[model samples]
Target: MDTLITLIRWSIATYCLYFLLNNYISYFYGISLNDYYQWFMLPSKQAEIEKLPLIFSMILFLLSVVFLNLLLSSIQLKAFGNFETYIYLGNSSLYDAHYIKDGDSKVIVSQTATITYNSSFKNIGLTQNFVSNSSVTDGLGKPQSAISMGNLFASLVITFFFFIPMLGPVHALLSPMLAETYTAKGLNVFKYQWNDSFNALLALKGFSLAKWALSWVAILVLMIYCTFRFPLQQFGKRAMNLPSYIAANQLIEAVPVSIKPIYIERARKPGETQYFKRIETSRRNVTFRFDKDFAQSVYVTAIVDTENNNLIEDKITSHINSHGKMQLKITDDLGIQLVKY
Candidate 1:
């Protein structure tokens, strides 16, 4: 229980440090604070979150500075490193943090993660979710649209290129703070100690939770500002005006006169073993339409849904031949369907 509390405190503190800095200078830089903590916003304003007022923003910044200073001075930074090791979230990628103890079975194993999110469930099968609703449409496993899937892939790229690239320096800067924290706690510097300061750990844990809660409130205010002040006009002009633009502009031309070589893919949710299969058949719909601007080329999309898996994927190369040919490649083993996507 103490280890869990420690991990939560460390994660909250790190997230806050990232969130606070992003929210603070964003006002002066004319950048949106929503970019970092948009997930902290209300559901309606998530995509359109905005800026913060200078006065309120300054207050939050000062508070974060004070809290961070206290945490660093108290050796909470080392506590954080120990907490990371405790939770198995450690890595040499961030810092060369080596905490070694002999003859201990428990060891921190560092691993990374990939985040995937689907915004809508447009083509998802009805059976995917136990109960379907208006907001999410279908269930958790529902496949994503091409554009939404693009966003998911974009997020992965950002995690690697943006976060990974910056974390090294950030980790290095924060590492020195551990010395002050150690001195305050009067701990052995040469040999690390643990499980001795219950009261101090509890106090830091409470404060970290409080700090995290207030950060969410600030995020909510910024989101409201963003939603109302969003530059929708410019986005609509460049990205596409949706149903409105469809009515105003010429209709999509050179639509697929005919489609051939109908291909179907089906599968059940994966089981403990790869060979496991369900008795029921699976259904899928592959759809296509010419691009709004380009008449000759149409974008192809496939909605893959089942009791076990839901996914939206596209072909790497989608060029209908000059002779109006639809080339769909399939395999005998239905599991091949899972591999293609």
Candidate 2:
């Protein structure tokens, strides 16, 4: 799964790079997408008539693709690495625990459950409650803390160079080498480029139909590579096993569990009745049973101790008037099985 996801990400990144490069060329050289197509399709006689300029443009496009890919790969690695770290930390006890001094409690356990449903009147409402003990963190060492004004400024400067017409590709090619100097000095050169504002701007600058199609094709190829290279394995294995480990030690009588509806789509038909039962959890698995009348699809998430304590999450689509039972099996070897009956 990780491999597949990585491939998808790379594929998307590749297309995005191509799109940006194409747009940059169009904006600077007044060349259209059709012009590129024609250049490749033109007969030898026609090509010979304009050989010099055609060769130059082709060379420029190829160079841009290579440079852009380098820059994009770095950005993708950093961005996805940070996201994976956040997921790991968020679900771990290190980030969710409450340090109680001199208290009999061996570990702080927090549980919360939330339910959301739309009424027959077409109004959506939510109910959430927390039970048992829970505490907030000092907010230190979070991923967000990595972002700073200096990083923002640096990102803006690097990104600005990419839009400077003829000079952009040169900078894109050289920027990684330049960034290595800072990296050797224990600095995060690409961290600044993760800014949301900068990403939005980049997306706006590169939006194009040809780019989208190219990106999709890239995604398909990457997906195939990742599927074979990376096998399906449970993500956050240690964290997922914490409950069973604590259970085995007999340090805690029960793992604090929470089941929440993270998202709920509208009912398929107006005034359709929707039914949901409280989700149940145990050391071995989490179970969700829905009644035949359920009308909307819901994305349900389960947590062991806190809201950030994600154990398993699955999307449940409504099949009206059909009884549904879904179970997520948990094992000590970090093996996961989703059974639907």
Candidate 3:
């Protein structure tokens, strides 16, 4: 039973770790593991998936560190146990001190004699002051015992599944908007006092610096692994079996024309562009009518037939003299054509 419970715990932790890693890679690297693998399989898209600029990548790395710090700090705060409770015993003047004779020492006898104290004084004022001072000291001094095992486990589960995996990226993206909102509501986010206040709160919550450092190391290691592992794997595969990869792409392109999917698009507006999907057909002329307006000029962006295959222009420009009626003549043999007026 214990082994089964331990296995279940490890399984949940592993799953949460994978979930967080996947989200981190997807957000920072612009692709997930599965998507990266699929793209690697397709040789055509290899050049299209460009690496991010160095400066932008550095900025993302810093942002991820900030987000991870915030997440771990919040979890630590929530998992920390409450401070020792202090009961008010009225004023110091209410209780009278009576000295009780021991063999060699004298002890104060009072209604609260059972209560522990640093000294022989029975004054509630001194006790209150001591408790207040010790509370602050203990808050930062002892963090390991400040958190219970059960609460830490629960907090970890919530942090991994919900906070880090789901809301981490969203918060990072919307942080600027949130700051503006706070500023509009009279809370200036750029102020240094807010930083001090946050530090004080962390101290009060018994945040462990050691644990935070360890978390940073772990996150950095994981980031490095996720960033390079797939790219290196792809490079190795291409270098090793280049012919097989090329053959796979060629095989995909050699699919039968009759079974190939056909896509047809029609213009909703007078000067809208139209795309004619590639197909194998006999040479024939096809006519189309623009019911809305007449086109003065027809700009063919691309035309691909059995003989002539060329992209006329890089971009399509709508014709200005589109008025009463328009007619279009397109050869049916043009396998792929893009027309605009």
Candidate 3, after superposition: displacement of residue 325 in Å?
97
- 203-289 per-residue lDDT for model 1 (tens digits): 443533244345555555554554344321110011111222232223222222222222434454555453444443444433333
lDDT of each: 0.31, 0.33, 0.31
Q: Which 10-residue span in candidate 3 carries the lowest summed lDDT?
A: 232-241
| Pairs with backbone N, CA or C atoms under 3 Å apart (clashes), candidate 3 | 294-325, 319-341
lDDT of 2 at 290: 19
Q: Write down the lDDT that model 3 would get.
A: 0.31
Q: Score candidate 1 by lDDT.
A: 0.31
TM-scores for candidates 1 onward, in order: 0.22, 0.23, 0.18
- Candidate 3 on 276-327: residue-level lDDT in tens? 4344442212111111121111111112232232221111111112322222
For model 2, give the 10-residue run with minimal summed lDDT. Answer: 118-127
- Who wins the lDDT comparison? 2
Tens digit per residue, CA lDDT, model 2, 1-341: 64675577556645765677567546533444455555536465242244443455446555444544434443444354332111121111211312111212232222211112111111111211111111223221212212223333333333323333333233233233334533576644445542332233244466543554455556455545544443321122121112223211121111212233333344445564554334334322222321222222112222222233333332323211233344444333323234322
Ranking by lDDT: 2, 3, 1
